[model samples]
Target: MDYASLKQKLQAFERQLDATLAALPSRQWASSSALRIASELYEIGAFKNSGTDRAEYLDYGYAILASHFVAGEVGYQADISREADLRQLIADLSFASHYYMIREYLYYSYNVPESMSWSFGEGRVEIRFSDKSIPRQFFTVYNDQMLGSQSHFRNFNHSAEIIRLLENEPEGVVTPNFETADPLMRAEADLKLAAYFSLIAPDSQIDLGGYSYAQFLNVYRMLLTKALYHRYLARAQDAVGAIYMPEGQLLDGIAGELGISLDIGRRILKDLVFDLDAAANRVDATYFSLMREGEPGGRIVMRPHHFATAEGLVNMLRVIAQRRPQTFLDRVSNEIGRAFVQRVKAAWEAEGFTCLSEVSLRDFDPKLPDIDLLVISCEPTLGYIIHVCELKCPVPPRWAKDQLKVLNKDSVSKAFRQVEVLQRFLRTEAGVQFLARVLPKEGHPHFRDFVVALNHLIITSDNAGMFFGAETTRAINFRTLERLLSRSDGDMALIQHILSTYDEHADEALVTTMVEFQLGSLTVAYEGVTASPLLEFPQGSWRSSPDRQAMVDAFIADGAHPFDVLELHPPDVVVNDHSIRVTADEEVPKK
Candidate 1:
């Protein structure tokens, strides 16, 4: 369907939905007693097989209505009270709208709730049907409009079926209504179901006993939204293994088919992941809290947010489908790079290599950046080999060509600078801890003293010929790695040779990139070293004048001096030689 038609249809659907809302008997639905009774009917329908009698069918209707009333109540309330940011609120509404419309369509297309029963004689006696229509019709129609005609079967199907059944039956005989079946009795039954569902609902706040139908509706809508997103995600995921395109392409196609915008689709996907992160933190917190209290299970009611993140991933294929193939490729470069790393890791492991991915330097020093992948291969001839791979996913080939040489040059410069920073960080105490974290199992015991040869690798989708190679940071095309993997079985020599070339072509200064700032005149404790209070230098700066260092050394050694010399040199303020300032408070205490 064209976008215009799909939009128009959507608008029509919304109008129908509003009518459905207006049709609801709020006075009855909002009644506490009525909600309670409806809940009881739902429980009965859930656990028991009430035969196809009028009373049984009525019970089913009560269950369906009660479920909606409670859902609407919970969802509406949660939505109003949701403490999400503006973006989150927008996402929530989008999902809720999608969910609501889908549900409404399903209800109409399949004649649900209403289809569950056929009332003969205009509500005198209701008869049940196990199969009047299929819910799958809605799924097929939504994804492909031509597959099924949209129709509001409503009570029409039930009425027709009842008419047919009655016409076929003996004229004198009729479906009998249970003697005790009445609105009040059904209400009572519904209340009992409501109470039962309250006890069993995963979320306590959603329990009908304490919360109204409106509030419950809010939560219910969110849950349904999450569920629908998940449904699409699962379907798209199944396509990923079979499709040649990037994962996002598949998701995009699904979204387009569903008439959902790529932007909205992506937002849903992102929100899903964020929600999962939140859920994970909550679970961890719960686990720790319970452990502290010496408790078990925690019996936590999995919140809707916990499930939202997961369902959010369903948007991947639909959202990604909207991008140009090149854009999709560029965005997924990390995924491709990681895949290459995994393959390399596995190949090396088979050939005796240890590899680690996503090594963070922040563990030792909270300020340092992280390494993407670190592969360590021990050779019988060579001592220890550590390969640090930093990936730069280039722009789309077309864009790169159009943008000219400046982009390429900038990329090369940026990459070399990163290498310098990484080399500097590695020489610090933090780098020592980082090495410990990535050390191979066999090398763990001797990691502290292991003599290591480090090789830096820059993996990028860009061709290796695009920029000049650095001594420590050598660019390797992603395709080259793939080809090498395909050709070589387990040859350490081939890999070592490639890296040796990188080492040979690398600048000599890369080896000495890690430097220590030597304070020549300063005497420091082995375990504790502090700079002179008067001197200020940038973090990680190693440059120091020899004369200043000598003066510091003299100051440290002058124990026989009767007085101390204190100077103030703020970072931005420089102190001149032969200058002394004495405050009134420091004039020998006026003695």
Candidate 2:
């Protein structure tokens, strides 16, 4: 379909989805049912798989929950009683969410093919490509690459280790002011909590749902204790179940533990109970909301699914602790930047490179921006090589919706601009003077006599795939940088080659052309391309394809093998189809 027609079709679909969701029952019931469904799906090993299967299961569950939270704000009678009814609801919501996600990407992406090749009619959309390989390329870019770049839970183990160290700190120490505190000090949960607490004025009573900050913290700790207890009991008994406690006894227990009165404890529990009335129209549901009044009796119920483990409790606490003043947020960001620089410095210094952190030529040239890191290495053939490093700690973008915004802000686009500015300034006469002042005294005299090469690198805490084949500035993940640093001692040649090359190999060792993508009725067929080291291929290796051969030859002429270009950089797959046909009730064509 034409671009305008395509937009109209997608908009109609979105409106229909909204109408369907608006007609659904109360979100509270939907949410509760979604949780139960998720639990069931997990029990059936739906989450144990990986790749497309895993994505499908997660999307299915998330769609049901998200639709209710998004559109079913008004309460109504829930008629979805049978298994088949619930399954159909899930299927409908899943399709809506899944279709919207793909539609948004296709509608808003800057990388969309210039030529139109897609058609839509009778509740189906089909996209065709002139080159068979384009489908695979699309999948590799959207699915495999994007999936591999997700690092949300990757740092849990690291954060857990940090928590372990923080717990060992002596208690009762005065909490330092996070704003003016030393950036080098390891971040402690207690200090972070205190920072958040200080945001509230002493005279003003801040109500988080109902409890005061202190009471909320106490309740949080109590829940964490219960979670830990359940874990321990489960291991000992070789079984898992809810922990039911007499409501009065639970209140009294917490009261004694926190040195509070029973009346106050009761008030806390009353406020903390997951009241569906209070949570209506709110999507910010927490583990605290899982605590419920049990069976009209004087008992409280803590289900196994409610705050499953201590780790989960810690994760929730971390999220809560982050809701601090902007000043505290800035300080935390600075601390993370400092830590990343220290890590990079240590890694490079261990490999015999002169590394500097927070290097700036602003004193000598006010216009020059500060560099996050600087590394200098001497090679027998290349003399002295300097790396101008810019560090960014951006949260990796989500799989859909405003991901491009994240990529543009304080990430790939911003990093590239900063690095380019620094490089431009460094190439000037003033830049040479500043560099001369910073260079080691021993090497200053010989620096001008020998060749000195400058290389720019943008290092991020998380992988950003948008600038994968960028030529002007190299973007690399910190993990990839660490790996390269570790190998530099024995393989400086490979390191140098990577630093100078503008290709996917700069970030990852393996390069593949295999790709696939599937979204609702749309499917991109996969084509497997054998992965091989580009360094092993010679010039004209891909002569069968003139374009590929030209690319290989260009890289070979630039003092590298054809493999370095064709294998690492690979030609962009072009979709040049001009014909479009719409079908009704017809099966989707397969490759």
Candidate with top TM-score is 2
| Candidate 1 Cα misplacement greater than 4 A, ranges | 1-351, 399-413, 444-450, 469-472, 486-488, 499-591
Candidate 1 local lDDT, 1-591, one digit each (tens)? 444554454455446545544454432233222333332322333223353222223332332232232222321222223334222333322233233324433343232233222222321322232221212111211222111111112212232223233332332232332111222223432332332212122332322222322333333333334232222222323210100123255346535544445655444433222122323333211111000101121111222212222211112221232222454454443444455456545644654467777777765666655776787765332235577777654431211122123134455446666777877666554454455445564542312222345667776543353324223455655544544433344344566565445322322212111111111222111111111111111122111224544554564465422122222211111111112322212232211
Every candidate's lDDT? 0.35, 0.46
Q: Candidate 2 — which pairs collide? A: 1-118, 139-516, 534-563
TM-score for every candidate vs. truth? Answer: 0.29, 0.55
Which digits, one per residue and each the tens of the lDDT, describe model 2 over residues 1-591?
Answer: 465666676576546545654544333454434444433332222323453334343443343344343232333333445666456545544444444444434543234433224455554554433232223223333333333234322332333332333343332133342222212122223322332212232232334333454665666556654544343334333334445567778777787777767776766665444434324523222324243431245244454333432123223322333333353354434544676678777887877778888986777677767888888776433245677888876433333332344345565567777877876676555565555555566653222233345677878654433434434566666655655565455245557665565244322433434233434343433223233332221122121344644664565466642122222322111110112111211222221
Runs in model 2 deviating more than 4 A are: 1-6, 17-31, 46-56, 63-86, 89-100, 103-123, 127-328, 399-402, 407-411, 444-448, 467-471, 488-490, 499-591
lDDT of 2: 0.46
Following a full C-alpha superposition, what root-mean-square deviation does model 2 have from the true structure? 15.9
